[model samples]
Target: MSILDLFKKKPKVNGIIKYLNLEGWWLNELSDEEREIILNIYSPMGSENSIIEGEICSSSQTQLHFFWGLIGWFNKPELRHIAYKLISKAETFIDKSSEPLDVHFFYSTKLEVFYKDRDLRPNGLELAIQSCEQQIANAPAAATAFKQKYDGNLPAHKGYAQLAIILEKQKRYDEAISLCEKAKSQGWAGDWDKRIERCDKRAKA
Candidate 1:
């Protein structure tokens, strides 16, 4: 990446570097090519040649901001399978020794990826569910777990809300309602009443 950095790299490359540079990120477990692909998916440039020896590059914004990361990447149905592969591997490679909240956030990302990747949905949902539940139980607040001179960047995972939405989508409306209720009790910042109302209506329907 250092040599790649010597040249003007694309947004994808820059984004991957940012993700890897995140404290406790373990990008070494992945190959250079794989890292390029992971970042490239987040690039708004669609598909293009991967960074090559001495190739000049450019960057841009698209339908979504690059800050959206895998969230934006996962929505591309054509690239969805690739995202599943990369995210699953990233989940393994992520350093658990990082700040607990960061760890929780990455694991919460798995819930979003699995829920969105309909083909890979069934096998991984339970893992995401359990992980998120534990996260909210343990580190329910960002400041509580992060404990640094606060930047707006590192915040608590919306584990309760994310899990509730997944549960709602799965038509486990009762569980969804219960989860939203728990989020409200825990003081998660979201419209829980509305979510609970929607879930209750669905449950009855």
Candidate 2:
């Protein structure tokens, strides 16, 4: 079965039961049936850590250990789903705290998760655009933060024009064009005029 097809099926209770049966040392002391029930409750393909943590706090270490073991079993899409949930939870926690660095860390982790996982590349690009837009919206003053972080040159200027292409795909033409202009102004040495002209045509069309 394709990975997508495997994911479409509900995670099998038998699989979890078998795993737990063989690795009972990793679980809190529970009957085989009880472990089966717990697995049934938390065995969904993309189950969130928070949900698992809440249910298994009696032996949270076991859950963590199990995840470590299961890590090899997860395909990229499954990993992406897990990483995204983790990033979302981390963002929420960061928002509730007074730590700006925590927010940055979570966002950075989110980007890394997207970049490292091939199955997530498309979603990662989409998330990158959204993240940049959010950064611009929430702190318009820091619109150049990405540029500053990326060597004082926007992605469009650094031969990473693919970033602009992604923005255009998201229908964020103005932002894409603005990025193209920024790239041109920064002297990163791309055909900025052609890019701007293409964006203009896209905007009009």
Candidate with top lDDT is 1
Please give, for residues 16-70, the per-residue lDDT of candidate 2 as tens digits. 3233342333233335554454344444466554222333323322322343333
For candidate 2, the C-alpha RMSD (Å) to the true structure equals 13.3
Q: lDDT, candidate 1, residue 190? A: 79
Clash pairs, candidate 2, are none
Candidate 2 residues lying further than 4 Å off, grouped into runs, are 1-75, 96-105, 108-129, 137-163, 170-175, 182-194, 201-205
Residue-pair clashes per prediction, in order, are 0, 0
Instruction: Tell me the lDDT of model 2 at 79.
Output: 45
* Model 1 stretches with alpha carbons more than 4 Å out: 1-75, 93-96, 119-138, 141-143, 146-157, 169-174, 197-205
lDDT of residue 135 for candidate 1? 62
Ten residues in sequence with the least summed lDDT for candidate 2 = 134-143
Q: What is the C-alpha RMSD of each candidate to the true structure, in Å?
A: 9.2, 13.3
